[model samples]
Target: MTTLRLSVLDQTPVGEDHTPDQALRASVDLARAAEDLGYTRYWAAEHHGSPGFASSAPEILAGALLAHTSRMRIGTGGVLLPRYEPAKVAEVFGVLASLYPGRVDLGIGRAGGPARDFPRRLADLRALLGEGGAVPHAPVPPQMWLLGAGRESARLAGLVGTEFAFGHFFSPVGGREAFEDYRERFRNATGRPAGGALAVRVVTADSAGRAEELARGLLLWRARKDLGEDAPLPSYETTRRHRWTGAELARAEVHRTALVSGAPEQVHAALTALAASHGVDELIVNTLTADPADRRRSYELLADAFALPPGGPETTVAHAARVPASVPAGR
Candidate 1:
């Protein structure tokens, strides 16, 4: 048992049959669920100009989730830094930290910042979140994470003195070296010492075949999405019916290669290995199943496998077992 902490990275996916409102609501519901399941944190993503996603403004959603749940840390899987000024971002998180104290996290991703300005923005952020800024009574400041994927980003994270969350789902090869670099170069001279995590795309089910089926199909849906298709996630039946073209199948493999999917034991072993090999304190899971129930179950099963601590209000949910009748095997 690796004792690896687990967190969530929710995109608030809007399926073909569901509305954006429903997707946002589901994010809240999942955050609450994550708290109960004993996950370490629940981080919502910030995506804009995407018809398939509902989490455009993660701070607002993060605040909502923090209000809705108790104990589990809540944050943006990353607040895109390019869209807003660093001081404003600092103030917003400062207020949130004042309200929730230790339960709030202000994770940053290199969204809008060009390479040269990244360090300056981080410096400004550090100053704004310092004792001189807003929240005086904040017992502890919001946890600052440098969400990165490559060598440069990792180096910047170490230089800026923030924890790192390597984006393994994006570029595995790049992220591996980046994680190593962060661990080697990290300097925790000032505030909280730097720790690191790896975020990966994961899928699991009752059986290995079912899990692979789900993983493969979900990859295809993502591929279609990257190609600018507004198609809703295909149902299991539809996935079964659609013949896979060579090109599409190859594209699907790109996603599938990074995905960890299988039965409970297999998934557990995979995650444990990943955590150990990467030397990360946590594994932030990004689940993208087509069915809401399956997605929820994946987290539940992982929590159980790790014997993670459960928190939050609703400890028992009968609704957990119910899967909508409409869902097919698709992603």
Candidate 2:
């Protein structure tokens, strides 16, 4: 078995009663804690016009996360490719790489939907970031990754020579085959070793029962999302109080299988098996809970379960460097 490497993919979810600002702050807190707990990378998600999610600008969020964490690599879980020009995306991440040097990544995707021209845009972005690409003016190029759910994206990532990340959390079907196709077709003209990561939804607690309880919001949220109900994540109480129809319950059940929730030991075993099946060493955890505390706790438990080596003592922040009260704590 390949040694497991864990990372985070935060969507900055806003709960029913929470504000987007609060959710952003929680993301920073989680990134810092995740770094101290030995997570290898922290990738912020981009969601457009969704009150349920707050991180519409992952590049900006990535900058904040990079400032807060000392060791972990920071990047966009993806900046939706079709929404912006490739040159602009390259330039943005170029500036980020200039600031953070080797600790920045540029993960691009199609905004969680199908796009006919994604492959071309992806190639264009890759060329601009390549050796003779548009980012030559910057100090260094950020690591590039293509985020996809199926074989087509996998093949594109391979042909274009960027790292491939599979969205197992949302598209669990054919994930194993996707990975196989990626590895077989990978061709890096730049000569970087072929790399891949699998992203999955996970929830963990001290007990299996508690984990299940914490995941109630996610099941409800998934069901709601499937039915075109675009609202903030529901609280545990909200999920419990809401009535569930048969179709909604069935939809939730279908999504439940994609979530790996249990005690740390149980979760670890499941994740390990999943990574093995996908033939990937890296696993990106995307935990969405109504309570931010539960989301934070989930990462802490996974880090310990995976035995990831924690970072050394945190460097002291000068008094003058402390964030002012007027500013959000996460910023």
Candidate 2 lDDT score at position 234: 92
lDDT of 1 at 25: 89
Our tally of clashes for model 2 stands at 0
User: For residues 105-128, what per-residue lDDT tens digits would candidate 2 score against the true structure?
Assistant: 788887644587777677666666
Q: Return the clash pairs for model 1, or none.
A: 38-309, 82-112, 236-328, 236-329, 236-330, 290-331
Candidate 1, residues 70-113: lDDT per residue as tens digits?
A: 78888888898877887788778877777886777778887765
Q: Candidate 2 regions off by >4 Å?
A: 112-114, 132-136, 187-193, 312-331
Cα lDDT, model 2, residue 10: 96
**Residue 123 displacement (Å), model 2:** 2.1
Q: After superposition, how far is residue 89 of candidate 2 from its true place, in Å?
A: 0.7
What is model 2's C-alpha RMSD? 8.2
lDDT of 1 at 116: 63
